[model samples]
Target chain A: MELWFSEDFSGGSRFGARVTQVVASHKSEFQQIDILATEVFGKMLVIDGKVQACEMDEFVYHEMLTHPALLSHPNPRKVLVAGGGDGGTVRECLKHSCVQEVTLVEIDRMVIELCQTHMPGLASRLSEDSRVRVAPDDASKIIQQARNMDVILVDSSDPVGPSEALFQPEFFQELHTALSEDGITCLQAGSPFLGPEQVVKMALDLKKFFPVVHLLTIPVPSYPGGTWCLALASKADWNPRGDSGQLIRQRFQDRGLTDQTKYLTKDMLGPCFEVPAFLMSIFRREQQAVAR
Target chain B: MELWFSEDFSGGSRFGARVTQVVASHKSEFQQIDILATEVFGKMLVIDGKVQACEMDEFVYHEMLTHPALLSHPNPRKVLVAGGGDGGTVRECLKHSCVQEVTLVEIDRMVIELCQTHMPGLASRLSEDSRVRVAPDDASKIIQQARNMDVILVDSSDPVGPSEALFQPEFFQELHTALSEDGITCLQAGSPFLGPEQVVKMALDLKKFFPVVHLLTIPVPSYPGGTWCLALASKADWNPRGDSGQLIRQRFQDRGLTDQTKYLTKDMLGPCFEVPAFLMSIFRREQQAVAR
Candidate 1:
């Protein structure tokens, strides 16, 4: 018999790898977490039956999530990652020389524990890094405390269960209040194909606080739709697209990221702002519907 | 029992939507074909057990296939499509009023007939369009006839089964010999992730004949590797990146394609050239191993 592990997306579609071995499986208080040794994706982390990250392609999502926000900010020293238990986001954040402190607030501690045991490259830094701090707590509450952050990266899952609160407008308001005056926060919005309305709504929610809101579409093949969005909101009046993103390019090169980065480069900043045409059409249709 | 239709990639990974109904299933001399009503992707066309196009996201794949090549060419009046049984490519090609004739050569006539019966939006143009000429013939043989196509799009499946011949180096020579001196040809060159080595080798093969060969990455969520590569080759000395693809923008405006296209925009021309980070790294590693 063939062993196939498929995650049912919205009870509609499913995508998963054939498992040679189920490395780890547990039912935490919050969700179900599993580590699978697969043939295609090296080692995959699954939470609540949703594929979180794979060893081979995790760099793409992590680098895309962190570098653009960090580089766009003039100085990103204190970074807060919400729901990134795998520690990939923290690892990317720690790449920047300016980043002095990183606080990872995940809803589930079992996720970090599993990663540290099974996936060393992703979770080892969460423990060994001197500048890092791990807080196994709810992110919305943490953001409500209004601790100033230079950058906040919402590395949450799809808008369901624990992550549903993260997509609400109230959570967005908290994120805005928690960030510094000139700060930038980028969060993983839902898939445009899977939840276009929610994706648009989440972006609109951010607009309630920040004048500058840009949705960067990044390819995450393991995810349900493979293409997902990262909503970047900034309190500053500055535009990310200014000077054809020369600032991002200059900063990326000056920071010696060209040699270090696997996926993101100085050349990629321009395309980061492009929304897929279908998504644009969805926005246009919704504009006729939504007042904002 | 719940029915699931998955296309296994290299027998290592799989991606599929749950089948609500089997609309059409046939075994032609060329390959197996199944039309499925899926819960997530709507009506999906499957060939040789591989998902080809879905009612929902086929636009993303078809638009990406047709627009860039047609727009980049000085005046793409005559176009040739190889192995595009689902008439989506023809629909996209005919969208350009400049195109005078479209010749669709396919190895399997049954696939076209099946699509014509079920997928009206995708296949109706084949029977109705005045300019479109549906040729139930081998694409390789058709290309060998030196058709002098201004733009040639190979809308074939993965380099396997009947579509295998379309990916050979000799086939690249035939494609070059068939095109005009200033012609532009774009072909789906398999997934960068599923078959990175094949992707690199295919791009290199195109370089043997054309001075300008670019690999454009597009997302097709239904496909095994949601992200795939399109190799666009040009006989002319011009780069598509000239003036940030201002030509495409001007042509889009002049041609009034701004109102018609769902996916490819003038703004997307810059990104049409941006290779995914992992793919770029793969290319770098391959360059170290393969000599020109």
Candidate 2:
């Protein structure tokens, strides 16, 4: 059996088709979330005919969010994942044997339940992890009083609708107070290639609250234009080249991590951060134009 | 007054505005080409609302194509460039004072006139080069009988409507016969990210004719996905690492040949060839599936 999902990314239109046998089909409260766990690739979470998440390309997002922060901090024993109900990020965090605890604060508990029930390939392994706890609650208010965390990952949806608060500077201020001095955070900062404005805006906002802010990019097939960006920030001076002690280079076939990754790789690390000169020049021109 | 024209490449659609004075507009025979010679980014060539070529970014493509061949051979004094009528390739070839002559075979005279008439920034530089001789002829038939050439560069359009012959296996066979024993050639293979199949086909076809076939990638904002691949082939084993002698390494920039580039850099070379795991597995599976 086979199935094909088409996303008219240029016009933001989506359509799906059943090429083979249908495993499951339904509608959820958030949107028409359909789970099609394929044998070739992994589980795929589709909403409104557009692919919300696919297991095959999820590692690009999960690794970019987790690895930068985990490697930045000296020791990351305790971690917090804000809004990743799919368990993919949690699964990646649990890979670190040094990490003893992980708390996933997702506002929509239904996303977690749907993923667990329909997309087992994505959320199944996390259910067996003893050090992980899935907490269903408002992430902004929940992290207001939290403290002593090594890393906090904001795996929220886009900046509108239910995830609007996640993109605000106030939410970042809350995250600023809820972490230890050595704490770091990485969040998906939209598409740098297609949405350069969003990247510049997010980097500017995070720079106001954090001492260091940098942007990274990764290519995913399911995503529009096949490229996306991740914003990394910390409360200390951060340089990817400067940090040497805690080296965490990700590869596809790393024993336990092998079965988890579909697209993330070690060779792709440096190129992901290499922004094109044309885009960088636009950013500079806009900055100088605005100053005048 | 200095004039500058910039193309808004924010999304899939590209639109160019006249930043200086409103210029005349007309259609060309080769394609719907628009020439906007500017002061900042050099001459801009617009085709079908897409930036076909810009003087600033053209150097990266021409340098990668010319240097690898000229450097690989002991002393490449004779060169032939197929379809690079803009004379960008000829200009780069002229850099080697050792080169006595360069033959530029272009199919369309319109392209040459367009550059000469409007794009003085690109064309004026070529008029001064007495070594370059512009021959109006079909490149496929032009290279067949040619002999004793130290280097031949197939700088044609993509393998579609007008360039279907360029990608054919027969053209590569003729190219193989035209070069000397140690002679080399480099063709612009399309984006590996979006056109993986095209790159693989070219690699396999070139391998049948040449002993050493290496694929190099450079990022170009005008191209789809900001990635471009180059296919190099020679009768002998041409190793870029081995060829980095004192002569070449001295000119080699820390960031690849990016000073002459707007996008292609040293950091972006390897990742351009690194296909996603799922894509690799699919390629492997298809090969295996076809063999069975």
Candidate 3:
């Protein structure tokens, strides 16, 4: 008999993998965190029974989450990441020399400790840098302390428990206040296939603050859905997927990050902004309903 | 108690869903076929214990498979679909008013019969049209019988059992022989994450017979890995994702298929061809080593 880890979705669908060993399991003040070694995904970090990050594919999620916003921003010196205990987002943010400071406001410190202990590849960046600070406090409160942040990334988990507040309109209002006039906000918006309505709702909420909002689809196989949607919002004329490949390449070269990336490329920038045709019509219908 | 249908991948990963009801189970001469009413996917067709097509997301796969090949062609009048018993590919083929005739060559008549019965949304277009001819025969043999075809779509399962031959050089050679000078060939290449080497291997083999070979990724969340690949091969000076959105939209209008598509869109055509940056480097490394 083989050991397995499975999570059932609202649609009664499941995404799971076989486990080889249970590295560590801890009950934090907020949620349960576990470290498991898996056959394919390598060291797996599980928080509240959800797979947070695995060695095999964290690059795709982390790269998509971090690089798009950072690379597209004109000068991202001050960064605020809410609830990415895995530190993958911070690791990508640290790649940019333009980033002078990073404030990681995660409510669960136990989750960060476990990731640092096991998933060092993702979680080690914060400790090595002098510019980084870990708040380990509730983001809704800590976000108020952040003012004029050049880039704000909400790497929160699903909209449940501690994260439910992060999805509310009040939080969007806070994020808007925390950012500079030209600041950009990017977050894991949800699955377009599973909950396009929720994604649209989040985008509409952000639209109340930001002038430009774009939803991007990234391949995150470990998620309940095979793909995840990310929303990019900004007050300036910042286009996520509108840049040409040559322009994107120039940004990478100018930033000295051409070869530093593993997943993001000049070709990937524009393509991700495309809403699939099936979802395009769905998005229009939802937006129209919300508009009324 | 909940009844679940689980399939384990070679990488120790699993993708399964709860079954509301197992509508039909048949052991055909070639493989085991199952029609299941799934909670989220609506109805699903499983072959050899692998999730083949589900009603909820089949449009993404079929539209990506059919429209790109049909639209890019200057004039796709004679279309040949190899192993698409689900008729989703056939249905998409019929959408193009440019396609005067479509030959659906599926080996399993039972699979076709089952699909026609249970997945009418995917399989009903055949009987409704006089242009379609159902050839329930082996693809390797039937492919040789076809010539001067404008477009050939291979809607095959995993390269195992009955579909294994579809990935061979001999079959690709036959596809080369059975095409008009400008004929294009598109097939369901394997998962880029799971079997990228196989995708590259098939593309390299086709490069022997065709001047251009492009592998495009499609989102098929029902599959183990949320995404799958499709390879486009042509002897003419053709490109799968080289055209602009305006050009792709023009193709749709010219073919009179603007309103017929559910997933394929002007914006979607170029994006799917972006070999993700991680996969892009791997593809190049493989191609360079092969070049030596």
Best by lDDT: 1
Per-residue accuracy of model 1 over A1-292 as CA lDDT, tens digit each: 7788887787777787888999999999998999999888889999888899999788888998898888888888899999999999999998898899999999899999999999988999999989999998999998898567999999998778899889888888888889998889999887778777778877877988998888888777788887777889998866655762788878898777876777776777878788887788877887778766
DockQ of 3: 0.72
For candidate 1, give the lDDT: 0.86
DockQ of each: 0.68, 0.18, 0.72
State the fnat of candidate 1 relative to the true structure.
Answer: 0.59
Note the residue pairs that clash in candidate 2. Answer: none
For residues A138-235, could you state the per-residue lDDT of candidate 2 as single tens digits?
78878896898888999887776567898889988888888888788888887654567877778777877999877776655455545577888898
Q: What is the C-alpha lDDT profile of model 1 across B1-292, one tens digit per residue?
A: 7998877888887787888999999999988999999888999999878888899889988988898888888789999999989999999999898999999998899999999999998999998989999899989998999567899999998777888899999999999999998898999888777787888888988888999988888777787667778888988876665762778768878777886877676788777788866678877887777764
For model 3, how does the per-residue alpha-carbon lDDT over B175-216 read when each residue is reduced to its tens digit? Answer: 999999989999998877766678788888898899988878
> Mind listing the fnat for each candidate?
0.59, 0.22, 0.70
Per-candidate clash tally: 0, 0, 0
Residue B156 in model 2: lDDT? 82
The Cα RMSD of model 2 versus the native structure comes to 7.4
Instruction: List the lowest-lDDT window of 10 residues for candidate 1 chain A.
Output: A236-245
Model 1: CAPRI class: medium
lDDT minimum window of 10 residues, candidate 2 chain A: A10-19
Model 3: per-residue Cα lDDT over A191-230, one tens digit each: 8877777888888888888888888887777887788889
